[model samples]
Target: MERELALEFARVTEAAALASARWVGKGDKEGADDAAVTAMRVMFDTVSVDGTVVIGEGEMDEAPMLYIGERVGIGVPPEVDIAVDPLEGTNLVAKGLNGAIAVLAASPRGSLLHAPDMYMDKIAVGAECRGRVHLEAPVKENLRQVAKALDKLISEVTVVILDRPRHQQLIEEVRQAGARIKLITDGDVSPGVAAAYQDSGVDILMGIGGAPEGVITAAALKCLGGDFQARLWPEDDTEIARCHEMGITNVNKIFTMDELAKSDDVIFVATGITDSFLLKGVRYFKRRAVTQTLVMRSTSGTIRHIEAHHDLDKKPLFKDHRIKLLGE
Candidate 1:
């Protein structure tokens, strides 16, 4: 992909963030998600590529837009695989909490895994520690290796995990290992990406999250020269069949960074809708809303932090339609 294409990905997430911020503290998750999806779809129309949604909200029957198999972009440049989470943390946005974001990653056609909407057992680390931490390894052993790789005390290392019931035992083990633990309410994708950034203060990420999110996070890690490993956790026979249908025959198979993204030329972009470890939430003033975004490209290993300001009093993109419908 051209260098300019990375900016387009940023624009998509920026639009989603701007739209979703309006629903903050409104306690409406579906409405927040809908606004983000609408804005994302509209922004994609202004891009210059034939983008296919490989990992998205749901299958075509369920979601109105940004659904799996849905096509985005303006259909001019190279065809690419698109993976998106219009609103990564709906609950966070509803509660006016942290870790909510609008995220996307794209690559050459067929480079990304068509991750099914299931649970994935994931482990991620920075590039220097790649091939050292294994999902099957004992928790203490992995922590020891990571601490050694970073030349830090085990007590000084911190692991980021989603606060879910299934992770209770994992949390206990990390605590027992004497490593610090950071439990997040939602949006494991951001934490996973943070594990790769040295200044992010996240040493590792381990837990089960949405499979599509695991792939998206892996894409970001790949761009950051980090390492991630995951295995699909099919909940039942139906989910197992779904995995098989997606050409995943070995349900217990483990996937590495290369296996997850399958390419080096990838782009990942995320705009924060709420405060999180990596990015801050949008802040609104009397007349403007401010947004922060992170955009990264694997080819150049460049990560850009973008801050934008938009006027709130300006007419929205759909104002003309609403006016015409009301015969104003």
Candidate 2:
């Protein structure tokens, strides 16, 4: 994909963030997600590409827009695969917590994995520790190698993990290895990407998250030249059948970065709906709404941090004067 594609992808993320921001602290997670999905779908119609959603919110029968197998963007140049998370952390946005984002990644057709909606056990580290950390290795061993690569004591290396019951054993292993643990309530994708940047204060990301999100996070890591490994974790026979339907025969297999997102020419963009480590949250004021976004290209390994200001007084797309009359 061309460099200009990054900007186009950023536009999609911006639209999603803007729409979701309106529902912030509204105590309605589903409303925030719906707003983002609607706005993102509308924005895709204006982009110049024949894009297909290979990994998205749901399958064609499940989600109305931005769903797996759904075609996006206007027909034009650069036929590509699009993976999107219009609202990565809906709960976070509803509660006005941190690390909610609107994220997207695109590459040439057939470049991204069409991951089914299932759980995936993932382990990721920075490029420096590439080929050192392995999903099959014991947790302590992985931590030891990561610490040695960074030239830090085990106690000083901080591992970011999701705060879930499934991670209980993994968390205990990290602590046993003398590595510091930072458990987040949700949104492992941001933490997975943050692991690649030293300034992000995240050294490694370990544990299982949504399989679709694993691919999304892998795309960003591929752009950053980070190391990532994952294995599908089917919770039951239904999930196993879903995997089989997706042509995944070996459910216990591990996937490397290349296996997740094979293309080097990948573009990943994310706009923060709430503050997190990699980007700041949208800030609203009487005059304007400000948002921070990060756009990255895998080929050049360049990440651009953009802060945008939108004049809220201006007419928004799909604005209904009737809503104002109703005090909405």
Candidate 3:
């Protein structure tokens, strides 16, 4: 993959962030997601790459735009596989909460996994503990290992997990291990990204989230030289059958970061829709909207934080009186 594709991919997420930021706190999660998908799909037309959606909203029968199996971008060289979450945390954006972002990843064709839309049990940590954290290990044991890797006491290590009823036992075990927990309402990608960076106030991420998200997180962590381990959690026989159809014979087998993202020739991009410790939320002021984005390319080991200022007047998506209504 060309290194320049990182910036081009960032443009796609930035457009989605700019559109979705207007729907923040609107109490309409679907509306916010719709705006983001529409804007993102529109912007993909401008990029020059032959991209296929390996992971996206849903399959063609389920989602109208940016669906799985959909071909994106103009027909060009450098065929790429894409994984996208137009709005990572729809609930966060709806309630005006934190940690919502627009995220996507692209790699050479046949690199990213076409993960099914099902739950996956994952354990991700920064590069310091790249090969230390294990999915099959007990929660407390994994915590102790990560703490040791970071040179921190068990009491000082902080773990991030999604706030879900399915994680009740997992949460209890972590608390018993004496590590602090940061439970987020939605979003699995940001926390994984945070865990990959030492200064992000997150040391490790655990518990279950969307399997497709695991692939996206793997791509990001792959760039950070971190590790992600995942196992398919089939809720029912139907899900198990789906796994087999995808040629995944062993649903219980754990997948390493290399297996999830395949190679280091990958690019990850995210634009914050709400403020968080990792990236700033979109800020709109005087017909001008500012956005903070994180872009990474594993090939060059290059990571960039881009803050873009857009003149809303020039954006056809928000023209004349439309910008004022969004600000209101």
* Candidate 1 accuracy as lDDT: 0.87
lDDT tens digits by residue: candidate 2, 1-328: 7788788878888878977887778887777787788888878888999999998874321443467788898988799999999989877888888889999989999989878888899998888888999999999999999999999999999999999999999999999999999999888899999999988999999998888889999999998888999999988999899888988888998988898898888999999999897889888787578889999998898989999888755735435321121115
Residue range 1-328, candidate 3, lDDT tens digits: 8877889999999989998888899887777787788888888988999999989873322433477788899979889999999988888998999999999999999999878888999999989999998999999999999999999999999999999999999999999999999999888889998998878999999999989889999999999999999999999999999999988989998999999999779999999999975799999899799999999999888999999999988987566332223434
**TM-score of every model?**
0.94, 0.95, 0.96
Point to the candidate with the largest TM-score: 3
Report the lDDT tens digits of candidate 1 across residue range 38-98: 8888889889999999999733214444878888998886899999999998888889998
For candidate 3, the lDDT comes to 0.89
**Candidate 3 regions with alpha-carbon error over 4 angstroms:** 58-65, 320-328
Alpha carbon lDDT of residue 120, candidate 1? 93
Query: What is the Cα-based TM-score of model 2?
Result: 0.95
RMSD of 1: 2.9
Candidate 3 scores a C-alpha RMSD against the true structure in Å of 2.3
State how far residue 161 of model 2 sits from its true place (Å). Answer: 1.1
Pairs of residues clashing in candidate 1: none
Error of 1 at 283 (Å): 1.2
